[model samples]
Target: MTIRAYRDADLGAVIDLWRACDLIRPWNPPAHDIAFCRSSGHGELFVAEAEGRIVGTVMAGHDGHRGWIYYVGVDPARRRDGLGTALMAHAESWLARQGVLKVQLLIRETNTAVAAFYERLGYAVEPRLVMAKRLDRGDGQKNA
Candidate 1:
């Protein structure tokens, strides 16, 4: 398999793969994936291609001081083949080159399996509550 930066043409396949794996919440609109790919100075998307097909994906980003990884997925048939690890290694290398001081990610609290996956990859949970409030116009009004 070959790992490479994402191309605009790969968007359809990437969205399909995420849906197939039930990776993102059902309420999340498909357009969000496109936005993530196009977001400026925030993140980069990558794909793992094998036999002319995209089989895995990852999104890596830096916030000046630290790097954040999100939306990592591998096709079900392609799991346990080291693609995830390879993709992460690529992200880590890129973040290091950019002088990011730390790397972090959040997994659903119910995803014990994935928590173990990250642990094996040398990631440990930070003992702090992660909170967020949407700032979109409709929600911003509620906060105000």
Candidate 2:
């Protein structure tokens, strides 16, 4: 598989991959997220293509001081083949190139299965609560 930056044509496939990997939720619309990243100028979305198919993705962004990763996913049938791990490594490398002081990603509290995946990559859980207040009236099941 080859990893490359996302293109406008890849939007639908990328969103479909996220859904296949159980990454999509009602609150965070994938299309809106993609549009924001592409328009913000500080974010990038990468895709993994194998056999002419989009199979994995990793979205990385920098908030000046730190880099954040989100929307990481891999084809369910393609799991355990190091695709997810490679996507993460790619994201970290991208962040390092941007001079980001730190790299962080939020994992859902109930997502115990992936904790070990991040932990194996040297990510540790920080002792901080992620408090939030929805500013958008449309926010219902805020999955972030």
Candidate 3:
């Protein structure tokens, strides 16, 4: 598989891969998340291709002091072949190139199965409370 930056045409395939990998959540609309990542120059969406098919994707970006990764997915048929690891390496390289000093990512509370994969990549479980407020609904309107 080959890893590279995302292109406009890859949107559908990427979204499909994410869904197949159980990455989509009702509260987090994929369309809006994709737009937020693509609109700002700080983020990048990387995709993996093999046999001319998109099989994996990772979105990485920096908030100046730290880099964040989201939407990591690999085709179910393509998992266990090191594709996920390679995609992560690519994302880390992209962040490092931008001078990001640290990297972080959030895994859903119920998705504990992926913790081992991340742990193999040297990411440890951190003790911190992740608080959030509704900026708006999925429609992109500001909360009143």
Candidate 4:
């Protein structure tokens, strides 16, 4: 597979891949997330393609402090073929070029398989709580 930056036309295939990988949640709508990343200009979305198909994707960027990765997904049938690792490597390279010092990503507490995969990539568990407040609810209203 070849790793490359995301394009507008890749939306359908990317969302389908994320769904197949069980990466979508009701609270985090895929289309909104995609638009945010595309416009944020802080991070990049990388997709892996093989046989003219999008097989994997990763969103990575830094905020001038540290780098973060999100929405990492690989096609179920395409797993175990090093596609995820390749995508990550591409992300890291992209971040490093931007002078990012540290890279971090979040894995659901119950996602043991995903945690293991990250561990294999030399990412360790950090003892920190991730707190967040949703600023935009897709309704042009802030949460009260």
Best by lDDT: 2
> What is candidate 3's TM-score against the reference?
0.91
Give per-residue CA lDDT, model 2, range 43-118, as digits (tens): 9999999999999999999998879999999999999899999999999998899898789898876787798999
Best by TM-score: 2
User: What are the models' TM-scores?
Assistant: 0.88, 0.92, 0.91, 0.90
Residue range 2-74, candidate 3, lDDT tens digits: 8988888887888889889989877778877877887988998999999999999999998878899998999
Of 1 and 2, the candidate ahead on TM-score is 2
Q: How big is the positional error of residue 76 in model 2, measured in Å on the Cα after superposition?
A: 0.5
Give, for candidate 4, the lowest lDDT window spanning 10 residues.
135-144
Query: Regarding TM-score, does 1 or 3 come out ahead?
Result: 3
Total clashing pairs in model 4: 0
Which ranking of candidates, highest lDDT first? 2, 3, 4, 1
Global CA lDDT computed for model 2: 0.90
CA lDDT of every candidate? 0.80, 0.90, 0.88, 0.88
lDDT of 1 by residue, 1-144 (tens): 998988878878988898876776754565675576457666788889999899988888887778988778999998888888999998888788878889999777576688877887999988987766666556454321
List candidate 4 segments past 4 Å from native: 137-144
In candidate 3, which residue pairs clash? none
